[model samples]
Target: MESHPPAGGHSVRTRSQHQRRKRIVQAAAALASRGGVEAMQMRTVAERAGVALGTLYRYFPSKMDLVVAVVGEEIDLLESSIERRPPGASTPASRAVDVLMRATRGLMREPELADALIRSLIMAEVQTPFGDRMTGLLLRVSAEGLTLEQASEEQRDLAGSLASVWVQELLEMLRGRRTYDQIQRRIETAAARLLAGI
Candidate 1:
């Protein structure tokens, strides 16, 4: 079974199917929030979502795919929040750091969920739908933070680099290898260094 829907020429889900899928993702997220990825069992998610276990599998062929969907939901919320209240720093780099740190802090508040999502993201194969959607969202948010009217090749590259720095620091934080302060400082230093000239 396909882990994700086909990129194009896919059959559309009915409204009820869409709602059920939403509930499944929400259930998985709630479980992860409470106890991280380990808690998000297929049976439990199906129960909480009020869908059959078979139905759950139909939507998400593997646990990793389900976790990736949960992460996508979280990032969507972050993107909406950023849109409502754009970062307020003066320099492009500072604004980028502000956006990245805001995301970092948000995840820190829900450490278990953060761990689950970030770990799944790291484990996902490159160019998969799950990976592409999440990466695009992160880059778009980074671009907004930079206040780019139009993203030049250089600006897009910087955004990708900033996202890489953010993800690496987040992994370190989740591993207990870096404190919040350390992560912040590292991200700040990285942004400054990477965006030095531009």
Candidate 2:
């Protein structure tokens, strides 16, 4: 008898590689949540992820690279939530409000964790490529589930600006400088206004 090649040419090693990367990211997230981003060393993550130190470095390459990947995953989760919301059931403005509020609430739900990530991004501690990738992800997600052709260039710019404002305001709220209720009200109001002109 002869052994056959597996589907997609994916041997056991291939599957293990995928799993190792996933586990490393999951372990990093958990550790970051508990002790903040500084605690997510490669050796520490490898130990928690049940992989060898070399495996962790092979998967992540660098701390900034790993964090940028984490931010990308976070954006995907947020985008999924926004995409799943029922836009047809209400006015576009209302749908936009819902999206902004949902994102704000999610940030509030993980104040310290978010602060750590944002601080890394803003301080240029992360590699510029990954930081640019994260900003692109934000633009993609914010523009998703929207019909932008109807809007003018200025309108599009305004929408993007409002999104940045909303994220910044949420950061302030996370820092305890503003209340959640205040952020919610301001975001909803701004989203509604921007959507109207779009």
- Candidate 1 whole-model C-alpha lDDT, 0 to 1: 0.75
> Candidate 1 residues 1-198, lDDT tens each?
545552111254677767778788889999999999889899999999999888787788788888877877777787788889877676666776877788888999999999999988789763345433433544454445333335567765766677787888899999999998998898888888776655
Highest TM-score against the true fold, candidate: 1
Residue 27 of model 1, lDDT score: 95
Q: In order, how many clashes per candidate?
A: 0, 0
Q: Tens digit of lDDT per residue, candidate 2, span 59-110? A: 6666766666666567778767755753443555555556667766776676
RMSD, candidate 1, Å: 3.7
The CA lDDT of each predicted structure is 0.75, 0.62
Q: Which 10-residue window in model 1 sums to the lowest lDDT?
A: 3-12
> Model 1: residues >4 Å from true position, as ranges?
1-12, 126-150
Winning candidate number (lDDT) = 1
TM-score of 2: 0.72
